[model samples]
Target: MKDVNFIFIREKIASSYLYFISFLGLITITISLLEIKIPSHSTILILLLIFMGIAEYFPVRFWRGTSSLTFPIIYAMSWQFGIHITIIAIVLVTLIIHLHRRSPIQRMLFNSTQHALSLILAEWFSNKCMHLLINNIDMSVLYENLISLLLFCVFFCFFNNRFYDLLMILLPQPYSIYQWYKKTVTVFLCETFGFSYAALMHVLISKYSVEVNEITVLFFFFPLVAISVISSFSVRIRMEKERLYELFLITTEISRGLTGGNLKHIKQALKGFFGIQAYGIWTKDDGNWNLLLKDGKVHFDISDHSEKFEGISKNLVFNDWKTGTAPGDEIFDSVIRSLVYFPLIVNDELVGMFVAGKSRTAGFFPEDVQSLATFSNQLANVVKTRILISEQEKRMILEERNRIAREIHDGIAQTLAGVIYQLESAQKKYRDKPIDMQQIVEKSIKDLRGSLGEVRYSIYALKPYPTQQLGLKQAIASKIKSLKQEYELDITYHERGHARALSFSKERAIFDTLQESLQNIVKHAQADKTDVLLSYQSEHVLLRVKDNGVGFSLFESMVKTKNEPHYGILHMNEQAEQLGATLQIDSSVGKGTEITLLIPDSQTRGA
Candidate 1:
């Protein structure tokens, strides 16, 4: 509750700040326009405005924001017709662009206000510098006022960036140092370009006529627009590559079945890549659609009729709220100007739905739709794969239960039944023959003990292996002690190098390999002693089990196990391979067998 209250207070403060800035900005513009005087060269002014609009339209986009060639024209205009004219012109251009883009009213206000304030400060700083440079310098002397013009560009860039930073602080978007540096460099470059072009325009206007300078301005701006268009194309190509890379990462995560744990990461990546404000994933459970994942602001009910989903299953459905072309306005909030539904289908079957929404009508372009379709297809396949894996796991569990049930019936159940029969016989014979009853009772007691042992063994087998609870070394030591007590088989355990924690899978595989090796020796190796060595290296961990017993041919054993019920070696090898490890068996007739399990570093980290 306190956190919520704190957040509410912060938002209120930010809102107040924004309103204050906007009010100041409006007041400044009103006052400035009251003193405004139209210049004599209306045709040149119109040409400059046109060029400014073009520059604003084709901004060089970066991750954080955009850069544009408007600075040169704005600076030049301020030098020619004063700061008020420059401010009004830029503000008008900004308002038009924002309105065309359907930007939020608050954002547009904030941006316009910030830009106006920065210009006012820049103009003030430049005037002070001009006075400091020369007692009474005429603005018409382009060569004499060069230093002042350069200083104006510098101060304007600084003030503009500072205001933008303040805006970011108030709104609070994610920050990146690399993005900040890139934006700073790009902005500086644009300012330099603007300074150079404005100087050239000043030179032309002073030497030639304002009319001649207008033509030069026109030609100069055309090339700039062309360059901006090229840059925009390059940015789009980069975005495409980034999108493909992001999809590859998501695909790898899904393939590893890590989606359950990495859903947050996936959501963030998708949101950043597509620039969507909200998204949701729904999966079909039985006959009902269930929401699996949802992120960002969601204002409307997602649980619409099944028929609506079925209708859109054939293709993606896009809705534009601004034009009233949306068929399902109730499904999304009024704030969402554009909403899209991508049916998650597999083999012509509607398995689920992926819904994404943005606050702009042209949010989903043709290329964006293509990418989203690919993403939806990938998600559908993953959902299907998850379902299939779940079913397979359940089936395996059921089979294991049946196997345990049979074991109980064949071993403990029969033994208990025999003990009951013997006890019943003894109870009946006790009255007639007391001496004979003692022997019968003793025999029944022994049978009961055997049944108890079988029950205990079954319980032990059902529980998790010791390696899972205890560390690998401790578990192996316990097993060796037990083997020594039970079979009187001489065993020695050795360790080398520093031990580090390994992943559960790697540990389990190593432990299982040890068990299989010992079991093979106990059953068939008619030998006296065995040795287990665990060596940990920088890049890999090695576990070797050597038995001084009657070893068999490795090739012959593998071939025989292929047909026979014995698959201990094959199973161990398969386990090692699955973990990107290696299992090697070195054995020959009459020579002792050696089993080595080498697990690389990749399998050992992330416990």
Candidate 2:
């Protein structure tokens, strides 16, 4: 629940904060430029600035954020050449790096300003500490500088992290205190490692000649760069693992059912993990493309791009509008500069289409497209399953209508015909035999009462007592009794263990599976006897429906189940999956077909 007023307030605060940071940064840059002096060691200063730029360019990224190896270079310059040169170096490197990243002007200014201010204030504080130490203790100049450098590094790390964390906290998005603490700890560790390297650089510059120090500085950065690259590689590996985990979670959620919340999770994952700005999911129903989920500023109408969607196969289709050569630019909003389109196909039939895009024109990474494609494959199954379920339900409704019609003809219709005959006879007897007419009228009244009872019974049987009133056990018993009475088949119901309460979803799944199984047995089993068992065990609940019937070939039925609308077993299995339960079917020619549903108690329990 994010309210409009809260969003407005957060936006106002963010805007004000960005403006203030940018102004302060610009002022710091101006003052630093005013105090600038071409130092005597200009070559060394140039070399340090170049290294700073390189370090900032290739930052080590983590799941939470990113870190750069620029601290050592910044500290070395700040100690050797003073604040003005260090400030100018930091500002220039920050600008170049941010510009390369296509960052907004406000963000670039804020980043440069924050880094510049942190370093300046930390340097000032460390100088005060160094002066105090020098006055109180009889320490060498080398020791004085070393202590000051350490203090600067510590203060710098603190200020940098504090400013960033404060911004995150003030933003509209959620940022927990626990997450903040973890991020702070991580930043501290990285800074500690960086400053340790800076310490070595400081000692060398102070003790060695300029030529030897410059050479050492140049070669020293090789290992530093190597470390950064290795850390980046590790981060990438970790990120991939995290994505795989996300995929698993998404699959689990969508498998439950087609719901708004499930679809929202997919949309959020795309935006959060892959930086997609716009997306649309469309399912093709009855030869018409219908929008299922959409977000951002996507302008894709299936009607407008029917040919394009029709042409898509197993491969992903994408375009980068920035290239000015990609097709179908009109299908997207101006803000969406790059996009990917994947067809959701199952059983070689296109069931749905997925489209996602980013504002950046560079388009999606290959691996990202691959991951999204796999997700769409999962989504394809769900869409297909939903379609099948809908068809199955429609068929069931028709079958029920036909059954009711037959019931009317067999019971109520015939009973009403008898009542009409008795009424006609009573009308005739009213004039001829008044005594016999009274008896005929009584028989007609009795037949009408039976008809009303039959209608009431049918209505009661349709109620969802499995989840609402009678509970699953009683519902099963009622269903078994109804089947026995209607088909005149020998039916047995047994219950074991103490029945515990189950979630509505689990109960519904079990009941629906049972209904499908019973319907199949009555229609096709050609058996004289049927048995149903409900067992509540310590770990799980089990339901078994067995019929002593002339069973069909299990192998052939499975083959048809895969390709055709064999909803009896297919629907049962789908319900089992939705409940996170297992459905096992066993049968052979001349042997009884047994259908068993096992639901783990952990899944059956209410949330």
Candidate 3:
């Protein structure tokens, strides 16, 4: 439920302007009574009053909205009847109109009083001008009547419009009065035609008073004038409707471009539809305007200046930048006279701005302001959507990298290290005899060949997630850069692999195990230099991380993990189980730590 009592003329001037107009109305009525005589043709006054009352009942649609037949009838009545009778008739007719309108008591009083004042002013102006333009002549003479008639008609038109303007100055509204003045010019032109009809009718009646009485003339002609006004109004409404609907279709196309994230299409649409000299999209970040896009002949560098927006208003259509009171007066060059600004709001937040400049001969109308604002809102929604998509893309890329690295570490790297340990032990046992060494060599060769084939297949299965079916080297390179930054260790990497493919899970396992081993060296080993090697043999794929630093015994490290339950060793063992690979740890009390993972050449080994 809206409270009607909350109505405001503005933040200020409600009481003051009301009293001021009332005072002026009183003075106008007093003057009309003191210096005025009643019209001899009182019937003419009655008929005109009745006509105005009927006109008010059925207001005609004219221009963007509506206009009344009351103005022309009132002007003619003021010219024919004397000020005393005419002023009284105006008050009676206004009361009838406002009472029927159900307008508030304060508004009805102010409006009716204002109309009375302008009418009295018009009457006085006509009488003074008539006396000055022509010498005193008999009221009966035709030429004298014509001279008086012409002077009164001119004054009637001038004072009627001017006094209406004067009444506006006493009130206040949210938007600037100058903006309203610009918006209402078209309506003013239509009203001019009505006033022209009033003047012509006044002249005719004054000229032909002898042949047909004023009442008889009025009875015949009033209906014809009413019909003409209504007919003109109907035509104007039809044209306006067609124009507005066409604008809607064009704006819909522009909005479509915005949704598709086509900046070029949006720019072209704005220029083609609006016919603007320049258009710009500006965003405010930390109170500075950033020019995101500019279209058309953007001659001035106003957007580059921080001072341009200072002391500027939030009004939609404006030309006030020329005023020296504004902060950046230099931005408004000679050619730029008018600008329309629309605030780009998204989700109820004023995030940015949209502004356009008009051609030299053209200016921004209220209709243009309304239409452009709609386009700006659609653009805001699109811009916000694009920002979200960009952020989401970055997040997804990071997650994919992590998944690939984890798979390689747990499978291929673990299996190769265990095969290397078995071959090293066989070397120690077969050292005493050449015949026994031949049999050991035969078994080791067979083991290496089988391991190598499985490692190749695993790498091949991880294709499309890396460089040429291999990302272990690339993943390791990424970690090396980070480790060097985090610690002062000089690390060297070597690869000895003919194998070039591995399964995604094997790739992830190998990557993760290598990462954990290097991280342990950084945190626990007092290493000055570290060696990382990837060796592919006939039976297996192997990875090694050896550091030259003060190191603890392998037994003591395992004992700590068993009692305190650290995740590092537990995680490595879990990954080894998942990949069916082997992890090995070698260290001495004074020497550094060495970690190796080995994968064999059987597909089922890490399945």
RMSD of each: 9.4, 13.2, 19.4
RMSD of 1: 9.4
- Lowest lDDT sum, 10 consecutive residues, model 3, at 1-10
- Among residues 3 or more apart in sequence or in different chains, the pairs in candidate 1 whose N, CA or C atoms overlap within 3 Å are none
Model 3, residue 536: distance off in Å is 49
Residue-level lDDT of model 3, residues 185-215, one tens digit each, is 6446546666566555656666676444566
Number of backbone collisions per candidate:
0, 0, 42
| Native-to-model Cα distance after best TM-score fit, residue 62 in candidate 3, in Å | 9.7
TM-score, per-candidate, Cα-based = 0.58, 0.54, 0.42
For each candidate, what is the lDDT? 0.76, 0.77, 0.63
So what's the TM-score on candidate 2? 0.54
